[model samples]
Target: MLYILFMIGLIWLGWKLIVFAIKATWGIAKVLLYIVCFPIILIGLVLGGLIYIALPILVVAGIIALLCGE
Candidate 1:
């Protein structure tokens, strides 16, 4: 009985740790996407003469940034 309880506790702790790790990884990925990838892609779109599409994307990103707040 004691061993079963111990096993349950260990499993719960492992699950919580995995959830935390996933959250942290997602946050890092978002930061990299916003800081690095977003600007490069935006510039590529403008240089490629896709201003029509790029303008909408830029507007949406700006709104998201404002809503999310730093």
Candidate 2:
């Protein structure tokens, strides 16, 4: 009975750790996407002669940033 309880406790702890790891990884991924990837993508779009598309995207991003400002 004691062994069974110990095993269950270990399983629960392991599951919680996995959940925490996933949440942490996702948060880091989002930060990288916004800080690093977004500007590179916008620059590429403009340099590739897609200014028409890039301009509207930039405007919408600006509006979102303004509205969502902390």
Candidate 3:
């Protein structure tokens, strides 16, 4: 019947709209992770290494100088 065909067409259109929305959201998430989150994480890691390694060495040197008192 024409009614049944109309119902089917509506369902198909609804399904396509839902799929399009999901794909759009997924694409946005991918772009944010790649462009924003990844570089921030990489910069944080590099700064963390400098703080962990160089900071302690400088502190120890300062303490030794203070104790020895030139």
Candidate 4:
């Protein structure tokens, strides 16, 4: 009776601890993943922005080159 209740309590405690650990591990994994991927994402964004900014200038230069027969 009492022993059974104690066993149930222990089981409940273990289950709660497992759940907490899993949640904590999942949160850490997400943060680490974001940290690892952020730089690559940032680099891609920077390159994309540079192309967006430079493409018009390049087109104008090409037009000038055509006019100059170069």
Steric clash pairs (candidate 2): none
TM-score of 1: 0.77
lDDT of each: 0.97, 0.95, 0.80, 0.77
lDDT of 3 by residue, 1-70 (tens): 9999999999999999999999999999998986798567656766887557555655675798699977
Output the worst ten-in-a-row residue range by lDDT, candidate 1: 61-70
Q: Write the per-residue lDDT of candidate 2 for residues 1-70, one digit (tens) a residue.
A: 9999999999999999999999999999999998999888999999999989888988999999999999
Which ranges of candidate 2 are over 4 A from the true structure? none
lDDT of 1 at 36: 100
- Which predicted model would earn the best TM-score? 2
Off by over 4 Å in 4: 40-70
- Look at candidate 1 and tell me the lDDT of residue 50: 100
Clashing pairs in 1: none
TM-score of each: 0.77, 0.90, 0.63, 0.54
Say which prediction, candidate 1 or candidate 3, comes out ahead on lDDT.
Answer: 1
For every candidate, C-alpha RMSD to the true structure in Å: 1.9, 1.0, 15.8, 15.9
Ranking by lDDT: 1, 2, 3, 4
